[model samples]
Target: MPQRTNNGFGLVRRGLAPALALAFTLALALMFMAESAQAASLSSSRADRRAARNEAKTQAEEVPLTPETFSHKLVLDGQAGSVLSFTLPEAVHKGLELTTFQDLCVFDADGTPVPFQLRAPQGTNQRLEVEKELPYFMWQPEKPGAGTPGTMDIEINAKGGIVRIKGQTDDLAKPGPVSYLLDMQAFFDAASSPVSRGGLAFADDDLRERAIKVLLAGDEPFMVSVTMKTSADLDSWTSIGRPQMLVRTRQGDVTLERDTLVLPGTAKRYLLLQFADSDVPIFSFAARAVFDKTTHEVRETIVPGTLSENKRQIGYTLPGRFPVTAIGFDLAQAEMMAVRLSGADDPEKPYAQRASGFIYRLERDGVTVTGEPFPVTQSNRYWRLSAAGDIPFAAAPGMRVYWQPRELLFLARGKGPWTLAFGRQTAVQASALPMLGQSDVQTAREIASPPTDTGATTPAVAKKEESREWVLWAVLILAVVFLSGVTVWLVRSMKK
Candidate 1:
C-alpha cells in the first residue's frame, strides 16, 4: 500500500507542475494582449484627433470656392469690375465653424472665384478729441459781513450729482477759501452725449489724464493762481498737488495765454477750483473737459443664449461660436445680485472666471436702471454664472451675448447676382487680395439666401464608420474571452 501511494503522489505532482506552468503562461499572454490592445486604442484615438485637425487645415487651404462646398450662401447685389463691400449678417456668424471666417468666399454667377479681403466692422483705430462744457456754481461765505472766506458743506447724490451746498463759519469768525464746484460727471458718463459715447467704450486707461480748458473772458489782464481738489462724495477731498497759474496777458498783436490745465491720475466725479488769493477778483470764465478718445469701428451682433441650471450655478450655451465682446442679462424681477462669470471653449473642460461684479436691474425714482454689459474677450462657446453669496434668482434669467461681426470686401469680377459662400469645417483662410480702397468701392446690399446644408453626413457613410468601430471592439472582446477560458481550463486540469 505505501509503495502504491508513493507512485500515485509522484504522478500527481508531475501532472500538476505542467498544468501550473501552462496556466501561468496563459495568464501572462492574456495580460500582454490586453495591454497591447489598450495601447493601440489610445494611439488610434490620438491619431484620429490629429487627422481631424490636419484635415481641417487642408480643407481651409485646398478647398475651392464652390457653392456646393459651403453650407451657407447669400446673394450680393452689385455691378461687376468694381470692388464691393458688405457687412456680414448675423446668420453668417451663427453658421461659421471657424473663428476667423477662413471658409468665406465670394463667387459670381458663372461660379468664378472673386478676390476678397476680410476687415473688422469698425474700420481702424481713430483718435478723436472730445470737449464738453462743465456746469459750475460758486460758493460764498455764510456771513456777508465777514471779510474772511468760509468753508462750504456740500452734499452729493448716489450718481455723484451735487444735491446741496451750504457755507459754514468757524468760532473765530474765520472762513474757508471761496471755491467753484464743477460737475465732472459728464467726463465719466459715456452715454451722456453721442461724441462722448465712443470716448469711453474702448479705452479705459486713457481716461486717467483729463484736460480742463478754461476760457476767461475779462476786459483787464489778470493773473490768478488756482488750486484744484477732487471729490467723489463731498466728504473726502484729494488735493492734486501744487497750484497752477492762469494768466492772460495782452501784447500788441499776439496775446500770451495759459488756459489749459492737465489733471493727472484718475479723475473724480466733482472738481473744486479754489483761488490762492481770497481777494482775487471774480472773473467770468467758461470751462470745458477735454478727452482723448480712441475708437475702433466695431460691428456688434447680439445672440440670445440658452440657459441651464447646474446644481447651485446657472450655465449658458450660445448657439454659435462667437468672438464674445460683452454679456448682458435680462432679469425676471427687479433685483441686484453679484455673480462670477466663467467661460470655456469646450463644455467638457473646466471653465475659467472671466468677470466678477454686481449686476442689477432696479427701478429707482420712476426710472429703470439696468446694469451695463460686462466686457469679456473670449471666443468660448459655454458660459456659467455662479452667485457670489446666497443670492438666488426668482426665475432663470435671460442672457444676451454680444460679438463683433467680420466685414467682407470682394471684387466683383464676372457678373451680377454674386453669391457669398461660407460655413465649412476644413476650409482655410483665403489669401488676401489687394483691391480698390474702401472709399472707392460701393457698399453692396446683402440679400438673404438659404443655407446649402453641406455638412450633413449620409446615413450609409455613418453606418459604415459605426460598423468599423464595432468590429474592432468585438475582436478585442473575443480575444480577451478566449484567453480567459484557456487560463481557466489550465487551472482545472492542474486540480484534476
Candidate 2:
C-alpha cells in the first residue's frame, strides 16, 4: 500500500509543471493587449489634430484678401497647447520647391512658428530630411525675377507635440499669401562697443538731448557711450553727449537719435530697436539718423558739461560710432531681410531670430519708396511694410500698424521695430538709404550746394536756371505757332 501511494504523488507533481507554464504565458498576452490599446489612443489623438489642420487649410483657400487675414491666415488651428495650422499663399509660396527637402517652421498662436516636423505627403513622394546637409530650412527665393512656381500637390505636416498641416492642393489652386513667420532676430554687435541698452534709461543723462551718429555693425540695436574725456593730466575726459545712448522705445518700439546727418535735406536716420528687455543673444547692428521731424531732421544737443580743467581733455569724443546695415525689403512681396550688418568688409550678417523686426518697402512697381533718392546703386533695392492690415512685411508684432495706402520702403534690424505713421509732409516718410559708415553719410548730410550768406546763387546754377527758363519759353512759343497754323488749316478745310 505504501509503494502505490508514492507512485500517485510523483504523477501529480509532473502534471502541475505544464499547468503553471500555460498560466504564465496567458498573463504576458494580457499585458501586451493593454499596451496596444494605449498606443491606439495616442495615435487617434494625433490623427484628430492632423484632421483639424487640414480643415484650416481648407478655410484659408476659401478666404480672400480681407483686412483680418491680410497678415496671414494660418495662425495655429487649436488651443493654447494644441497643434497649429497655417496656409501658404502665393506671395510667400514662390520659394517652396517640392523637388527636394521640406521647410521646418515653428507653430505658434500668433503667426510665429514653434519647433515642428514637416512631414511629406502620404502615399506619395517620401519626405526627405535635410538635417544632415542643411539642418534648418534657409529661405532662398530664386534670384529676383527668377522666382518660378514650383510643382503643385504639396502638403506640410507641422508637428511639435501634435501634428498639423498647410500646403497646396488642386482645389486650392491659387497660391495664397505665404503663411509662415520666421523666428527672426537682428542685433548690434555689443562686442565692438560697450553693449549697453538704451531703450529706456540711457547711461548718460545728456544722451537724450545729444545728437549722436550711429552705424550698425550687426542686426541688434544697442548703445555705447562716447566721452570727450578731458586731458588736464593728458589722460582724462568727460561725457560730451547728453543722455548718451539715450534710446527711446515706445512699448516695443525703439526711437533713436542722430547728429551725424546723411545730408541736410530730405533724409534723416532711424535706428531700429524692437526687442523687449531681458532678451539677449549674439549681437549685431545697423546705424541710422532718426530725425526729429518729418523734414528728416531729428537733432538733439548734448551740452558738454564743464570739463573740470582746461588741459583735462584729450579730444572731442566723436559721438557713438555709426553702424550701418544693408537692409532690403520688398513692398509688393511684403517681405524683409536684414541681409547684412557685420563688421566684416561687406557687413552682411544673414542670421535671424524672433526679436528681429520688419520693414516695409513703400513701393510703386519699382518706383522709389518714400520718395527718397532710390539711386541706381539700389535699383535692386526693396522695402517691407509693418502697419497692421497693410501686409505682413509692414506690421510690427508689438504695435497696431496703420498703413499708408501708398507703397513704402522700411528699414529695420534685430528687435528693430516699425511704426504706423501718417505723412507729415508732401512726402511724409523717407526711406533709409543703405549707408556706408559716416564716409557715405557725410555726402548726404552735406548741403547739395553750400548755402552762402551772399544770398546769390552760384553763377553755374544761375546760368543753368536761366537757360532752362529760356528753353521753356522757346518751346511754348513754338507750340503756340504750330497750333495756330494747324487750327487755321482745319477751319479752312471744314469751310470747303
Candidate 3:
C-alpha cells in the first residue's frame, strides 16, 4: 500500500517498521513483568539452607561450661547488673561459698576488706582473695545449700554489695570496658558551704536571737528568715523587742548540722532565700532578729550579699523606698516560685516601716497552676486569675478570681486573716488597706501554751495552720539565688 506522506510525514514513516516492532517489544516487557513477580515470591533454596545451618551451629556451642572444679573470669565493663556466675563442685572451696542464706564473697571497688566474713562449709574455710594483676574475682561457697548444685540461690545482705567487675571475660588479665557508674556515690555529701561564726552588727539594740543552719546543697547557699516569735499558730509573725542573740556569722569550715540558719523552724517546708543580683557571690550573711518570749509567726528571709566589700541590707524595703523588691526560692525549684517586690519603702526617720504585700489566690489544678502555664515568673508575666473564695484543697464551682483588698501576704495561712501583716514593725500598721475577715482556712495553729508565769494566764498565740494556701508572694520577694558569681566575687571582694 502506497502511504501518502507530507515531507515531514515521510520522515516519520521512515522508521515505521522499527516502530511496529517496538510496540511488539513493549507488549513482551509487560508479559515478562508478571514472571519477575513470581520469581520474587521465592528465595534461593541453597542460600536458605546455609543460613539455617549457621544458626544451628551457634546454638550447639556451650557457654563455657565446666565441672565443679572450674575457675572462670568475667568483666563487668561498668554496666549495672552485669554479673559473673560460676558453677563449681563442692571441691572448689578456696573462695567463700554462697548459699540461699547469705553472700559468699564481698570486695569493694578499691579492693578493701568489708566487715563481713564469709562462712564456708563445715570442714573448709571460705576465703577468696583478689588475685593481684588479674581483675578476676575469686569466690567459694561459704556453706552449700540443701539439695542442688547451681539451683541454690546466692544472696547478699550488707545493705547492697556492688561488685565492680573490670575487663573482659576473655581478657580478665587486662582491662577492656572503661565504663563508670553513677552508683559509685552511695551517699555523697554534696553540700556547698556551711557557716558557724562571723562578724554581724545590729543598729537599734544590737539585740537579736539568731538560729542559723547552713545546708550543703546545690552549688549555692540558701537561707530562710525566722523571727523568734510566739504564736498559737505557726503562721502569724510578730517581731520581739529584746534581742536574744543579736546575729549569727560564719568564718570557718561549715558543718551540716551546726550550719546556723538565720531563721528558726523545724518544719521541712523551708523558705529558700538568695541574693537580688543573680551573680552576687555570698561569702556569708548575718541573720538578725529581735527575740521575745511572747512573739509568734514572725520571720523574713535574710540574704547576705556584698556584705564583705559592698553595702549589706535586706532585699526588700518598705515597698516604694526602693524601685525593686528581691525574692528567693528553693534553689532546686527555681522554676516554680520566684519573685521580688519593688516600687515602695518608707525612708523618713522615725521610719515606721509598714509591711506591704500583694494578696493573690493560690489557684491550682492537680499539679498545675491556674493561668500561668510555664514555671516562669519574670516582670509582667503574670496572668490575672480569679481568687476563689475560701476553699480547702478541693476545687469548686463557686471559686471566682477576685482581687483581695489586703496588701500583705497574711490571710488564712498565718495568725488571723485580717490579723496578718508584712514588713511592718507590728502587724497593726502594715498596709493602709484593711483586709476582710480571713476564712478559717488561712489561720495558722495557735501555740498550745504560752510561757506562763506563777499564777499568770498565757495570752493566745497564733500561727499558720494546715491550708492549701501556697502563695508565691514570699518567694517573689526573696529569690534564693546560688552564688555562681563567687568565681568572680571572691576574686574582687577578697583583699588578698
**Which candidate has the highest TM-score of all?**
1
Model 3 lDDT vs. the true structure? Answer: 0.24
| Candidate 1 worst ten-residue window by lDDT | 456-465
On lDDT, who's better, 2 or 3?
A: 2
lDDT of 3 by residue, 1-496 (tens): 9986556445445544454455546545544653453343233333445555554334323322111111211111121222211121211211112211121221223322122211111121222111111111211222422111121222222543224322214332222111111111121111101211222222323223433322233334333232232222223324333322222234466522234434443212112232112222223323223422211121122222211112212222111111112232212121221222222222232222222232223435645332221221121111111222322111211111111111112212111111100110111112222323223112122222221112312122222221112222233223222122432343343323
* Candidate 1 wrongly placed segments (more than 4 Å): 1-28, 52-63, 123-310, 334-338, 349-352, 360-370, 386-396, 427-438, 449-496
Q: What is the C-alpha lDDT of each candidate?
A: 0.67, 0.26, 0.24
Against the correct fold, how does model 2 do in TM-score?
0.19
Candidate 2 lDDT tens digits, 152-226: 211223321111122423232122211111111111111112223322212222121212232333335543332
Comparing 1 and 2 on TM-score, the stronger one: 1
Q: Which stretches of candidate 3 lie over 4 Å from their true place?
A: 1-158, 163-183, 187-320, 323-388, 391-496
Candidate 1 lDDT over 369-433, as tens digits, reads 99988899877878887788875655557777777777788888888788887776654455576
Q: lDDT score of model 1?
A: 0.67
Q: Could you tell me which 10 consecutive residues in candidate 2 have the lowest summed lDDT?
A: 129-138
Question: What does the lDDT read for residue 471 in candidate 2?
Answer: 54
